[model samples]
Target chain A: MSGIQYLFPEYEVVRNDDRCIRCRVCERQCANEVHCYDEGRDKMFSDESKCVNCQRCVSLCPTRALKIVKSDCRLRENANWDSDTIREIYKQAGSGGVLLSSMGNPKPLPVYWDKILINASQVTNPSIDPLREPMETRVFLGKKPEKIVRGEDGRLVTDLPPQLELSLPVMFSAMSYGSISYNAHASLARAAAELGTCYNTGEGGLHEDFYPYGPHTIVQVASGRFGVHEDYLEAGAAIEIKMGQGAKPGIGGHLPGAKVGPDVSRTRMIPEGSDAISPAPHHDIYSIEDLRQLVWSLKEATGHRKPVIVKVAAVHNIAAIASGIARSGADILAIDGFRGGTGAAPTRIRDNVGIPVELALAAVDQRLRDEGIRSQVSLVVGGSIRSSADVVKAVALGADACYIATAAVLALGCHLCRTCQSGKCNWGIATQRPDLVKRLNPDIGSERLINLLTAWKHEIKELMGGMGINSIEALRGNRKMLRGVGLNETELRILGIAHAGE
Target chain B: MKRVYVNEEWCLGCHLCEYNCAFANSGARDMVSALKGKPLVSRIRVEGDGRITYAVSCRHCTDPLCVTCCISGALRREDGVVRIDRGKCVGCLTCVLVCPYGAVAPGPDGAALKCELCLQNSCGAPACAAGCPNRAIVYEEREEERS
Candidate 1:
């Protein structure tokens, strides 16, 4: 019944007549409008083709009556031409357009976090309970003063420039206001404020409502300069120059005109309904010296009050790239791995580009240490840091602190359906639609996020306590507390961690 | 009519919706008593990689393809809600074959299971939406805002 149909639906819906109470809850709850009741027949019915298997109806059926099953609609059995592969090929042949996917890459690539193991204390070093001992997770990100300088009064100089102090060693990563819903930003802002951490504005500029959270915010400057202005540059506690993103390392981003609504338009200082394209590289920043000029310009614009963070995607030569950034007068360097997420990206670029954050962090840390400039700039690593163990591992790998977006969002309730590009999210965290966006009550979102961070903070402390480490400062770059499992010599050497059971 | 809007950005990949959905429909007196490691078979599911996460559930589209492709007379629509009658179903799964969102899945008895918006489950709305700590899964009516 179709002229060149797409991939067929994969499941069927079956309702039981004997259990037909006809409450119609499925009707109201379905966003796809798959379920409807027949008045003339006085019975409930379903259009199985529209069903997404969200199970909202079956779970709420009350009568124990609804079922969805895999369709027997299989293509002829062929290993070379599987159903999904054939469908994908047909889809490409039909549309002749690149398949764009939302979120991180779905390929079963290596995840470095799972392979690295954290060290624990033994009889040599007694383990201390975080609850009973003074285990510190708080970290300050910025330049630390070197050898003490004497003043005229022969007293140590306590004059230190601006720095970001995190109660815990984690800050919400850069996620632009345009990419996520206002409520999502609200939750993050509230959590950052409550947790005494910072949240990056991710080149979307600063929203009027969030300027009040400036002290706890890190305003970003990407290639597009969508919302960059004098006041915007001076607003946040830190100014981050986004050289690249982990999701699509070498490519630029184009926020389709369709998604650029009034709020996003205003926040980004761009014309409404206009495409927001962030170019791959800033025209002004062609070299490291040019990057230096930009950093200095921002410092001059903000009166050198805020720390300047230079964020780069973790590429093959990230260590060398980071060394230049360290000397470029940047206070902090943010390394984002390939596993990072995005609102929308070409499927190919997301899956096949960039390296893992762990390796990048290790290489950068080692390079900075070898250069004897490790203390000049703080290091922050991000891109899919799942649990407290990861945070611990990152610190031991030499990260001064960690920046997280996915985990932060998860605490607020993301399910990872990978449909963010559609912008019809039911939870309201990703969509700009008022009805959907309003559903995310920032109060609850903030509360849940706070709970998650508190839990992670507690866990980080416990992990640190078990390692016989008293503070997060001591844990930084302590590769002695880490071991590699099932990794080759090169990987272990790159990570600067010995193999397990060694 | 109201619908559940997914804010995929807020989804934590926790799969709480599946557990809550399962518990809500479990007909259990308490959530823990029914779902404390009971091989969850909830109507909704979570899908994601390490970086980002979101929930997958019924979208309840306007002109459903599942209805047009059903081999049996089991699939029907009335008052804008598409539902099914197992008694009339042949379990052919033609509906699943045509659904573009991949929202449809196999049920316990090899039947189809999906999100239907809580009409009889706990809470006046949906359990997944209400119990969602992040407010990622919201139940509401769609509006003509994305032009």
Candidate 2:
């Protein structure tokens, strides 16, 4: 034991003695083992230090007796050296390891989606009633033909390039098989199938059970190429080359050996109990030319029937990077913003690196337009697309579609406690342990996801109807429909939107 | 007829169904007032080891053994639900022994008690299925052969 304790427990578990029935449900449900019943005292107690405030015990408490609150305990209040900062320093000193975190960045930063406001039609233009009028939310992601051509017979040619059709402009983004549990993956796959959209398989290989959902899947090949195979490439409507993730932009992924169970190992084609380390960069890809080779190889491998997507993090030169990827023979370009969620990442890189997706999307869209290659590829922006409003805003800013992972997992029962590195997720969304994995029943999980997307589909229609837009295609890249509030001139210029009331 | 069924695969074994069943049938306005600091006499009970668990209650069979064996004529099948009349129960312990599922047990009043699908209680539906966190227990009509 340490001679002196330097840190205080962050949370206090409050149990109402009157309401508690001593059922001990909290004691059994908590994976952290924070709650215990003292048989001698005939009462329940909690070790608050171990509590992650996941609300598992509170949700399961039959009598509504438990509540977790932040402790008021402080250490010489100083804004310059906040309590969390000091505690983090102490933690690093004690453990001598890099600070790791999960989920999206919690730091207070500018959320452009919140600052941007959508325009609504008033007396001048009649807003269509979505309930009575026909509205189209369907979107297709792929390259559009530069010009129309006719055959020798003078009949108009209808053949177009391969495209991934989505009933709505939203998709369940990549959260690999190994990163999330099998039940979680099953839920996403089933929901995507039922919703007529797609879910990315991340860098992890596709599970055999999900093969029937290939039409609603987007197989990925990242740095490690963990599950990349001929059958795997052919099993999806599209393939994404994961150049970098928004969280920890310049680094790679590290799935600890402990989470690599036998099923995860088989799906990822890796040995059980072995750390799955994806290198920082794909050794074969260094320039746009190299990227073009891989794109063409994947296309050739798939009989040139599937569209290939190139995904990159929003960095300093994201516009130039997007331009290069568009010319690299990629059919779709996916840009992930700084506020993206991750299974596990170094806290330093997650909190520090990368640019916001709004600015990146606007910049890339304008750059492609100026280069006369706007139709060369489709643009999909991800990294914290929290709601239908965010989807509408992203589309107006020139995104063909939106990718959402954090929001999808939230529907599948993720509380975002930001402790995924520990792999003790009580919700069963992030862990591979059999007991926790079974906690998420695919039947309930899939139903919830379907409900979320269905609701969003309605909201997206209503928002578009208010804007006097009937289809998502007309809303795509229509920057005039958006205006910024409380944003500086530079911010407004970068986002390519006027100030509100202009 | 709609019957409460257990999937077992998704059952968390937290025994929340048992608590919900007890509280729903307790006839109190709230759970704290209903079953606090007292032994839980739940109509629906969860039975299993740590690996597997499922809630067990009356199956409401077409030919119930408890209804046929009730010596005091307390147990009866009403609208396909195996119900009991506590006023007529003699507490002979015969229903407890004849029941194959062990779903019947003596209540705190020394009367045989079993699940009546919450029809007699304030809850319009089975509380065990309604309170199940993982959808492990579902009250729905299925093919008799499948049940």
Candidate 3:
């Protein structure tokens, strides 16, 4: 084990000697200790083996003299057994542990959003200018009455269920405090408040410092129920029951003891330096009735003033499962697809477990309408909504809103290095270390997040205006404005859209 | 007057500000040719313990002690900026000793060196403040303290 080396360094740190001024800025900024100065040689050198390709050194280099590139050296190529497959086998043989990865799945799977083309008004209908006229992007998520009800006096009943309102149909999904840093959560909370949107507190109870932003918070309850209290339950505008996540659908979550620092432990109500592991499934929820009881319990605890959301992974029978949740008194259903992001997950389970969100969203919407219970629950789909176009496509396929975590963290300076499991995030969004966490100032992070969402809001308005739809409510479930470019008959039928030529 | 201020909370202590200052004042074509294999004499320096850090430079106080103590007339207060005239400096080291913030230092040619907010350089503004990645060093004007 000590003599043989099974793997080679994947990335090479290229430093231009002529351009490097020996400022040593890269050496100081990297948390991985990849770069160091050899005082005797009067030069700087990098240890490529420790480099994660996170681009921290390259970004902070004062002279722009550093670049990271994938090593060109490779093993003999085979069509069926690629280099990555062979490397994974060697790694497992040596370590005897499951491969862990961070962020979303990187496989080249089918992306329905890319295949779907949007329509525009031609010579007949006129397109509205968003700058000149009013374009309503606001949406309210909650159950709606099937028909107008009248009291004994024949007057219209105006009372409706509690709802979660948003300036735009996009939200920052659940990335818990224990999984990310305090500054990341601070940035999200401030940005959500500024944008008139909501951010989910993924199973990590609400931090006391974020209580002022409660109106823009969604507290989540998972199988472990890490920090469930009366104050914690009341600290958010809505509650989410996280039955499963998109990444590692059938497995549970585990935050290593090293990351369970005092702040994270206090926030999660766990002892310091102890691992926080969530069970695979809720112990009390074996059937739909059990789900209904929990939903009602949360609603009752909140005094029936806040909406309840049930989040589940998009799987084979998602349409039927959504039907059960809709009838279980849950006001909102959040479906996480296969490509969702996570702080840590088994590589195999993350790569191959759940179904694509586009098909799941379409099937559930159609099934709920067929069952005449579509009005009882609102649908929100998440996994990898990358841009405004994805959000627009999701709404056209009957999603009330879209949840985005990877894109949100990217806005806060994540390079998508896919090495968050190591917990030494150089960019500061995923690490709990005080030095690394301080790298992300909430002032800059919040401003950047606000800028990203504000830009997306304008793009959404433009896309809606191009379709001659001035309001988001008018674009909801409007499949007539969508066409499939490379979809087969079954996919086109499932998506309920016509072929591009037709 | 606009002045450079430091907020210790966000300082990353990466020393990029010091490098930017040296390069901006070097007057060379680029940072590589100016600072390569050279001992840096940056006008701004960062002072920190392990846990906390902050950049220090000329404060340009209302009544500067360095300006009063310069016997060779090298240090002068011009439009609220305490600037050093390297040509007239006598290398007495009086200003370096008199500066309370320890910002005044001797240059390579035995002249007193201090921060002029980059006004004398091609930058036309403070490079240390501009190059700060975390906005820890800022150049702005705020309400004066009554005391």
- Candidate 3 shows a clash count of 0
Cα lDDT tens digits for candidate 1, A1-502 = 3485677776688876665445465664555677887879767777777765645556555455677777888889997777866876876888788877777777788888899998888999898898887877788889888678999999989988789899999999988887888989998999899999998888787888998998899999999998998888777999999999898898878887777899899889999989999998998999999999999999999988889999999999999999999999999999999998888888888888999999999999999999999989999999888898999999999999888988887766666656677776656666776655765778888998999999999999889888889999899999999999999999999999999999
Tell me the alpha-carbon RMSD of every candidate.
Answer: 13.7, 1.2, 1.2
- Poorest lDDT segment (10 consecutive residues) of candidate 3 chain A: A1-10
* Alpha carbon lDDT at A350, candidate 2: 92
DockQ class, candidate 3: high
| Fnat of candidates, each listed | 0.10, 0.82, 0.72
Report the TM-score of the second chain of model 2 against its true counterpart: 0.96
Residue B82 lDDT in candidate 3 = 94
lDDT of 1 at A479: 95
| DockQ-better candidate, 2 vs 3 | 2
TM-score of 2: 0.98
Error at A296, model 1, angstroms: 0.6
Which portions of model 2 show Cα errors greater than 4 Å? none
Better candidate number, 1 or 3, judged by DockQ: 3
Relative to the true structure, candidate 3 reaches a TM of 0.98
Better of 1 and 3 by TM-score: 3
